[model samples]
Target: MRYEEELIDEVREKNDIVDVISSYVSLKKRGSNYVGLCPFHNEKTPSFSVSRDKQMYYCFGCGQGGNVYTFLMEYNRLSFVEALQELAKRAGVELPEREQTAEEKQQADARLTLRDMNKEAAVYFHYLLKSKRGTQALVYLKDRGLSDEMINQFGLGYADIYRDDLYQYLKAKGFSDYQMKESSLVNIDTVKGNYDKFFNRVIFPIMDINQRVIGFGGRVMGEGEPKYLNSRETILFDKGRNLYGLNYAKRSRSKSLILCEGYMDVISLHQAGFTNAVAPLGTAFTPNQAMLLKRYTNEVILSFDSDGAGVKAALRALPILRENGLRGRVLSMKPYKDPDELIKAEGQEGYQKRIEEAESGRMFELLVLYGQYNQQDPESRTEFIHEIAKKLAQIEEPLERQTYLASAANRFMIRKNDLENLVNRYGLGYQYEKVNEQYKTPPETEERRQEKKKSNKNQPQRLLLTWLVEHPEMYQYIRAYIGADDFIEPLYHSVAIMLFEQLDNEEKINPAAILSRFTDAEEQKEIAAIFNTHLKYGLSSEDEDKALSDVVRKVKLASIEDEMVHTSDIVRWQELLSLKNKMQKFSISRS
Candidate 1:
């Protein structure tokens, strides 16, 4: 069962929407509402609005709107239950323990089972690392400069040579085969049955932000073709969405994050007291991971290996970090392969110094480009200058772009105007429009464009829905005349049906309450757009009545016209014409 309605009401009352949103966004008072740039999307203008009286927020640019719960769910990517728990904590509301419904219970059990299985596997592997079976692995870790305390803190463990040791242990512990497979800890063979996914390797448990063990990574102790093996994508784990050691890194309270290339680099950095270090899980950095990092720190330092592949990876990550509004810097690890080797040779202080001396992303890219060609060669210099111009053009700030342009001119001994022109030609600063000479709006083509223009045409329907929700007493009168079938747009249709049903059930027509009925983010956005749209002209009681009558007539006329197009028989066409005539007469009478 869900939380008690009284408790939900109390939570909502205590946690005002403006107060909650103000913590994440810098909202400024604009009339009765607060306005800020949208956190969901990158924008310069303040299109996100929060209403103190209505207890809701809406982004006109992105169309994301809802109450505090919707904001938490979208901004933090949390589930409804998770958002509720978070709000309950903030509101200081004591939640009564209740029994879960069968479906909820099953889902909770599945997640708990996976977490418990991973925890047990971590423990079992840790024991093996300390046992005689893990002697060589322990020696290997020691050679890599890992102390016993550091190993224990990181939950480092070893999987023995036996293929099904973990499999047998988990099975004996009463874990179901399905749970094990779902956890991605065991692989099921068609003929061989189930076997451990990690063997003859040292295991590193990957955890969620809450520090719950979700998956594992294993590095082979001895020589192997594939030296590192990570958990496959499963219900509990997505490799691209997770970063290794983030659970610990976030607690460092550091102003910046050190994004390394591998598990060892992150672990080594943490062991060296630079706890704010995280690495992607066996894949290149992703936009999701970049956005996640933006939540923890304002700056990110890329500390990949000093190899060609690592430089390329860093280059790719630069734009992603910029897109997510995080400052990215590059740590030059030349004369050393990675952080692990650098820390091993020069200690923590040396690594810290290197971090301090790290260059900005643009500077790093320029340096890398400079190394590719000799300046004495005229053709190579031209190509290099153009490449630098393209990179400089991507910088949005005028002052920043000017600074880079000046630097480039000084370095290449070229006129800054030539480079600026090249940047405008190749970079995002360039604006080009193509004219289509054969563009024509046929019936089918117009229908295709209807989705874009539906917002304008359906304004009356949206206003009617909004008015019905704002004045539930009017729902009875509106319901007698119109139904959800009158709404042409699916989004508005869904909202109308929900509003009618909610009114019939005597439920409050609140944004939060209405939002709870929807699970899709897109649907929530549309609902927010409907709620945020303000009527151009004021609707007094008399005006509201006329507006409702006019909208109903318009809807009926549209319905008739739509039916007339589909009607094949003479009788159906005549009936549609009669309905249209009656709607027009009713509209005239109401006016």
Candidate 2:
């Protein structure tokens, strides 16, 4: 009925499901269908299957299944309309008359205008740096030993001294104060109204993993009170989660990720030919940031500043990395306090050598300082060992802890047996696998329940729902065989009912079709994830006789279970047999 829906229908009619899917996946023929490794999630074996007759695909491994349109949405992270438009272009289909709500139209227009503003601003600043006005900033960057390639790679720019310059430019280009604020390109002062936050500074754009300019970071041209300035928090910018230069780093390298303290360190490392590098925004290292790094490289080399504060920060971050299943190590830089200075002192090759020599340290080693091991009094030493042994027991690795014990024993001139006895006294066992399991869970407590509740808030349901919408042919089969009523979990049940009802009557199932029915965006997401998990199996051509018979038997059993306590339990059974005999004689006449 809608223009977008009509467009999607046309695209689906024009493009064969197999043709579109084959573009991204390596499909191998097996009997009547094709099989491949699931591209959505990391897995070694093939669970992804495509059926030409059904015009759908499924993954048994990840449970992601769908038609060509759904494949594009998940693989490329495109919206429904975007995916439709792309398929239409490939299929050569003309779109129908378009209509969008006034609010939707305005938001789309605002994003376009903001993008233009950002592009123009980035180019303008780059031009300013080449001009006489940008000489001071250019010299300052060079003084920091940044190469021209490095500067250009980061899209380094300069803002004029006047704060109103960017503000006026953006306003003239038809961006509202709110739009500029959303883009994180402008800041508002109570007295000054709107102004450029990066005025009179050299700018480095902070990009997402996809390399889009989500926000900016600026450093003063010369010595200023606040030496470095960065974009304020906005809708498009989240400093705690984003890393600089990861977009390029992920594409260029596959080995390891270099985690540095500052944005400049990340930029400088990329410039030095160590392409696999990333750095967090102003916030301290987070569990989320650690998990993100794990996607690209399980191994992480941290290059914190060589100061006391930096050492303490690294120590604090080690536990977070270990908890997230990343193999983390520390890069101790010599002859310089920071990564930027170290890279500048030694050429790129010198920095590479240090990264190679990086050493892995247990969290306890960093937390306890060497002085605790060498206390003058034996009692203090014993107490120190007990305190640290408890912490080491928290570590999930068996051999790693034993290795630490052996090393600690050698350093403290204590017998290995004594160290092992002390560790056992604290109930820190030597079994890495079993010990890791003990550390996995805290006792059932109110605080732990609250933490779980907080985490459940961020679960991705829309992704699951979208997957379901993509695979419509499986609707009847899933309902008949799997039974929507079997889903007892609240979140899964809500999605199952919605999906079952959506496909019950429709000739074709489009996930976007049901988006209008649910006002809650999170519900839409949950529906998507549900489909994603189910689509992995797709629809089977296998006979449903057994499944259907089982359902009937269950229904019969439920009736017996419900009537077990009748008013006249024995007489009720005789009455039921007489009623069945009478009903059978009437059925025989109809036959």
Candidate 3:
């Protein structure tokens, strides 16, 4: 649910972004905006820029950018509503209660129905675990070192061997087969008739961060092909988007999350008092999962299995973690397959010791890559070094890159300068092409090239919108020829609609308030980048005029070409061609 735009804007107006951000981050004014080391990622230099003029913040290093609500959501792991409530309270403003729209209300009702069904199903499963029919299943859990209290805490249960047991129970409780199927608790087949989804398996209820049961996972008590079966995607569940024990892990005071490989591993860790442990839903770690982790903590330690598959999974997860602005570490559970095995061999203290000595995300990747090649052989070692250089090049911040590069050089007995050169060579080749395309002049210095790497038809639109944001006075002349429809780029087009509306009404253009209109983080980030786009300045007025003209012409040409592609009518094509040629001669008016 979203608050009304007027109410959101009022709250935002009271809580200045710079003032609010200053309480959390030590920001010092540099030029027109505030500059500080980005709190989202580790950096020696201050790459995070906060603009009071626009009321937005962006990490030039990590690409995390947004308005005030976004800042709270990312920095403190609060949801949009949560952030809104906090800001409203802090500013001593009252948020007005509002009713949901017809569509929103209907959607809400459906979600509520699903939640109620999942909750009822969870209760039934938990009750069965303590019943006479669940004796063998209970015995299996007990043998696996699960106490009655732990079982109760996790809402663990068992499905009887009878296929129709749960189906009948749910049906008697007034939940239709359609609802049951939607909840993924029961399946109705024409040939096999209706039956339970899980039979003769230990059930683990997968709850959301609110501790509401959204889905379930069942591990087979005896021999089975899958061995572990998780609830399929339903209205209430998306395995890729949700983690198994986040409800508990989010509350852990620890600053890091311990990511395990499976349900048993997560439960075992929780039982052993590592309350911050979580796991993916029976799949490889995903970018979404890492971003989810980013909300709770900046660090996530990978506690995957130590076998070949586990090593591969860890390697796969590390880059995703780094990309999502997390400081990922990898722990070794050697001589033991998993955390559960390790807890049995050595106690909680030993596990803590292993965690303390976990390898840094970079070191782990480097060491794994190093192990893959014969270090003593020159050709293999050179290949290994190049791989190392490529990985180093991916780190956008030079200081951080140099720090890791020097460490890699020292570890491998290579010269720091040589490794640094290899990294820069790889980094610059790609950066030059991308940055060169965005700007007319070749990036003469590192700072110029590091502004941004965007290249596409959208770049001009992004550039023009950014220009309007920084210099809205130009809209008096710019609007005569260009309009929202001319943006062509979908996101830019949407922003331009609002921007042009505000400009037309002669309202003060507040980029921050405009940013608050977007709800999704990715949308807000792109919107922020639009407001904060780095427009390279030319040396003279003539140069600046020429650059602006080029951007306007590019934007107009792209829109014309786009219209011609969709229109089959010869008249429309001819009109588009005439406009394209006219736009080529379009000049800025001073009036």
Candidate 4:
């Protein structure tokens, strides 16, 4: 309704849901619907079902369902406006410019202003990188094997030795102290006032997937307390949620990403023609980062430092990758400490060969565990063999697990049958543990969004609304006894009112458009479930009438009971008692 309803319909009509989702997920035709693995969660089985007829998708496993716009917004982590713009462009439907309200305009302007400040700051820093003040920084970068082209490509720059350089520059450009502080480019020190956060460092402007400069990473030019510093979490950026060089790396035609440890690693890899490389912004890998990566690529190649800490980092990252259904591999940069050193010694062809030869994540883990134990020692070797079996048990697929079982036995020169017995023993325990975990209660946040409150009253309200959606022609018959107000649950009542209004006006109900009415992602999903709940198929006409009659009575009786609890008027109370009696005989027919 914000834009004309027709405009949204036009956009939706132009871009078919199946066509749009197919680009992201590999869906197979199954009856009238397509099914695939749910991208929102890590599931081996395909439970994500898309309906071509309804122009909607629902994941039976995760229960995340919605129309095409919601699919794009959820999968790409885009805002509704951003999703609209993206779909509009793809559909070739030029959206008419719509005016923003005062409050909305203010918020939009603030975000725009911050991005503008960051852009201006990038230009200024890039200018200074070429200026005399950046001589030392530029020399250091060049010495590190970074070309001038790479420097320009990454928008690499320098923060002058002056503490207030960027602060002064931003202030001169008419940015307020509040804006400067909010941008995270300047720190507020009561003693020093506003000062640049990245002084005496080489700067790397961190861009989002949209190529907007939201934050910055600055490595100290010389020895300092912290060698590298990143902009703190701000309205514009969260380090855990964004990856460095992702703006360019995401465009790589490859289905995988080369994940590195630092900005230089990503830059060097990009410069060496591995433009798919990206790195966390001076933080350990996070689940949010994993989900973000999942949106872009199915696999990630871990290119970490070859030092002990690097090995530890890789160990830490593998499980998170597995949890998100990402196929992780370790880059075998053995002779070199990191990707930079490897690339410097061997170049792109060697790196490409290494990438092709990257080990599977489980194998990498086994190798790391192998390094910890001395195979020459009898006790250490026995423990290492047990560890391999335990890890192999964790692999849920029998074909994959059995293949690893043989590989581990041959690779370690252990008896295949002996190892197989230990794996089977561990696999049983793992299976038991997994089954137990499934029965444990979900977190409260998930409960709130997925299933708000399930009760006897809730079920009837939910079913009645769903009934109206699937059989709108039945609304006229059902309206004689129960109305939208009788569907007491707030969300259900709101939806019922809309359904009735649309029906009264003689317009076909658009469930997807109704979903557009709720902007909050959680509410949209909850609303989607009202229509998405599977109705019993192949019902006898008599059975259908009985089901509808029963649902209507239940909803009406519950609504009356709820009203009786709150009513203060004696006359209204008397009417409610009489209405309660009238409700007991309430029944409707298909005719």
lDDT of 1 by residue, 1-591 (tens): 678766776777789999887666667798989987677765545678998766788987667888888888776656667687899999888788877778667767887788789899999999999999999999999998888888998899999999999999999999977778788889877799778999999899898898888788899977895888999876578776689999999999789999999888888898899999999999878766876787788899999999999999999898777756689999989899999889878888899999999999988899899999888999998899888887787676889988988887787677978887888777654322111211323355665678668666877778777776666777666565567777867777777787778788887776666665676777777887778777545756677677767877877677677778877999889977977887786632222
Clashes of 4: 0
Clashes of each: 0, 19, 0, 0
Best by lDDT: 4
Give stretches of model 2 more than 4 Å off: 1-107, 172-178, 188-191, 222-225, 344-349, 363-368, 371-379, 428-591
Model 3, range 468-544, lDDT digits (tens) per residue?
88778878877778899998867788899999998999888888877887777888888887777788865466666
lDDT of each: 0.81, 0.65, 0.84, 0.85
Give the number of the best model, judged by TM-score: 4
Comparison by lDDT, 1 against 4, better one: 4
Query: How high a TM-score does candidate 3 get?
Result: 0.69
User: Could you tell me every candidate's TM-score relative to the true structure?
Assistant: 0.74, 0.60, 0.69, 0.78
The C-alpha stretches of model 3 lying farther than 4 A from their native spots are 1-5, 12-92, 188-195, 234-236, 253-255, 294-298, 375-382, 385-470, 478-501, 511-588
lDDT of 2 at 544: 33
- Which candidate, 3 or 4, has the higher lDDT? 4
TM-score of 4: 0.78
Candidate 2: RMSD to truth: 11.2
**For residues 223-308, what per-residue lDDT tens digits would candidate 4 score against the true structure?**
89689988998767878778998899888998899899999999899988999999999888876688778888899999999998
lDDT score at residue 96, model 3, on the 0-100 scale: 73
Q: Which segments of model 1 are wrong by more than 4 Å?
A: 4-79, 92-97, 223-225, 234-236, 416-494, 497-512, 519-554, 557-580, 584-591
